[model samples]
Target: MRVLVTGGAGFIGSNFALRARERRPEWQLTVIDAMTYAANRASLEPVLTTGEVALVEGNIADAALVDGLVADHDVVVHFAAESHNDNSLDSPWPFVESNVVGTFTLLEAIRRHGKRLHHISTDEVYGDLELDDPARFTEQTPVNPSSPYSATKASADLLVRAWIRSFGIEATVSNCSNNYGPRQHVEKFIPRQITGILQGVRPKLYGSGLNVRDWIHVDDHNDAVIAILEQGRLGETYLIGADGERNNLEIVRMLLELMGKPADWFDHVDDRPGHDLRYAIDSTKLRRETDWQPRYGDLHAGLAQTIDWYRTNESWWREAKVAAERTYERLGR
Candidate 1:
């Protein structure tokens, strides 16, 4: 099988690329990444030498480039997008360009190539979960995005759906929650906390630090995506997650315990505008329909190993941040 993955060097994308190589050694994989601050080529450096994996550095919004790649590959997994909420908060234009326009670029590829498409999304599109209510975000949940990031993602999701309904396209969407584990960019909460503890930086938690998120390890998330390709019905969206819910304060406490750091190491900062209180996904449909399962033990065990990863892979992420430094310099941030 040949798969063209946009943004495959990023968090979930890198994991998918690596896992795809393992699952199908003969598969020819092409990864097109824009090499943004959040993208670390070294995260995918191991696969670079594999010969089967080819890396093309470019933006997904480049319709000509995306169309050619989508035409060549049997499956186009559109994982590329402006992923960080904080970054999106600073600049929604890029989010609109990448998540919305870039997604449309891929949809155009499907229109021309007639290849299968799978678009990765976030559970944030369902907006804040009501703690007192019994509702959990399912594939059928109505979108009520609370942030610019989720808003753009929701917009792109709708566009992809429209292409399917109107153009007779083969497209699938996976709306997942917070992902943790190796190769995650430092700006994300999990790796941010892990890297902060390692570097003696006091990680900041917004508000009371009680915002809840369903945690899914990246490896398990990759498995779920692979299963969708192998077994899922096209033109359908799947909610991929471990159904493990955790609060920001709880995650911070775990990181503190694992690193032998103290609660004093945490700095409670003012909350970001439009921050969601919680995110929960009902993944029962995904579980019943696919042979996929979460391999990372439970929330605690997965996080324990994840913390150890940053502890051991400090050089990996330190080198990874050099790219961010350049972006900071370029933007005068």
Candidate 2:
């Protein structure tokens, strides 16, 4: 099988490529990424050297490029997007172009070529559940995206469904919860705190640090994607999660403890505008339908492993960290 992975230079996409190589050695893989500030070519260097995977630097919104790439590959796993909420609030246009326009381009190509596709999306598109609510986001949850980033993602998801129903495209969509592991940009919450502590800087938390997020390891997330690609029904949506629900404050405390710092070593910063209070995902369909299970069931063990990756590969994140911190400073976050 020939597989084309979009945004393969970024965090989750890069890990997906690595895992795909290990799990499906016979498949020919190609990655087309925009190589934006959030993307790192080094993440795919290992597989590139072995000639198991080829990297193509391009934006998914380029119809000419996307049409050609989609025509050649047997399947397209789309992970391209401007995903940071803060950046979306600062500038919404890029998110719309990358998420909505890009998906439309791919949908057209996939429609013309009759190629299979698995659209990757986020649970934030379902908006946030109340902090006190016991309900988790299910497949039936209506999309109520809070930020520009998620709004564009929700738009992309809707586009896919429209094409699937109207044009009869072969595709599936999976909305996953928060993913944490290696290769993540330092600008994100988990890496910001981890790398901050490593640099002798105090970790920064937003608002009261009570906002909740469901965390899953990138490896587990990719594993589930593989299952859905292989076994899932077309025109279906699955929610992917590991049942690892944690609030911002609890996560900061966990990181501090893991890094041998005091629990109170972090500072509270201004909360994001219109920040969602909490997000939780229910993956009952994904589990029952694919027989998929997560390996990093313990959040503490997963975080410890993540911390070690950052410590051992400081070179990979050093330059990016400098720019990311500067942006945060400008925002006073």
Candidate 3:
């Protein structure tokens, strides 16, 4: 199989590329990434160095480039986007361009070439649930995006559904929960706190730190994506998660304890505007349909493993950390 992986240099996408190479050695892989601030090329060094994957530094919104790449590949796994919520809140134009316009570009290319497409999306598109609510987001959940980042992603998902129905495009979409693991940008919640502590800064929490997020290992999330791509029904949407729900406070405490610090060794900061109270995912359909499950179901163990990665690979995140901290300090976040 010849596969085109968009955003293959970013966190989940890079991990997808690495995992794909290991699982499908016979498949030829090509990556097209915009190489944004969140992307780290070094994450893909293993496959790139071995010639197992080819890299194309370009934007997915480049219609001409996308057309050519989609035509040659058997399928496209789209993971590219401006995905940071804080960044989106600060600047919304880039989110519109990269998430909405970019997905439209890819859909057009796929439609033109009659190629298969697997669109990666986030559960935030379904909005937040009450902290005490038992309901979790499902495939049928109506999009109620509250932020620019999620609104753009919701727009992109709607475009895919429209294409699948109106143009009969072969595509499937998966909305996943929060992902944490190596290669994740330090600006994100888990990494920001983890890297902050490593840099002698007390971890900062927004508001009361009661905001909840359903977490999943990057590997598990990618595995589910692969399953949806290979075996899922066309035009179907799958919710991917591992039941790893934890409030922000719990995660912070766990990180502090894991790093050998007191659980109360963190500071509180102003909350993000319109911060979602909680997000949960009900991935029953995905598991039943694909017979897939998460390998890293233990959040603590998974976090420990992730901490080890950042600890040993300080060089990978060091430069980005300085710039990210500066931005945070200026914003007082």
TM-score per prediction, in order, is 0.94, 0.99, 0.99
Model 2 poorest ten-residue lDDT run: 324-333
Candidate 3 local lDDT, 1-333, one digit each (tens): 999999999999999999998888888999999998999999999989989999999999999999999999999999999998888888899999999999999999999989999999999999999999999999988999999999999999999999999999999999999999999999899998888888878999999999999999999999899888878999999999999999999999999999999999999999999899999999999999996899998999999999999999999999999899898878778
Q: Which scores greater on lDDT, model 2 or model 3?
A: 2
Model 2 per-residue lDDT at 303: 100
Q: Tens digits of per-residue lDDT for model 2 on 105-217? A: 99999999999999999999999999999999999999999999999999999999999999999999999999999999999999999999999999988999999999999
Pairs of residues at least 3 apart in sequence or in different chains that clash in candidate 2:
none
Order of candidate numbers by TM-score, starting with the best: 2, 3, 1
lDDT of 1 by residue, 1-333 (tens): 889998998888988999998987877999999988788787888889767689999999998988888889999888999988877877789999999989988898889879999999999998987666667889989999987899999999999999999999988989988899988987678887788678777777888988899999999998999899889998999999897888899889888887898866788877877889889988899889999889975888898888888888887788656565455335443
TM-score of 3: 0.99
Evaluation by TM-score, superior candidate among 1 and 2: 2
Model 2 lDDT at residue 230:
92
Give the range where candidate 1 is weakest over 10 consecutive residues by summed lDDT: 324-333
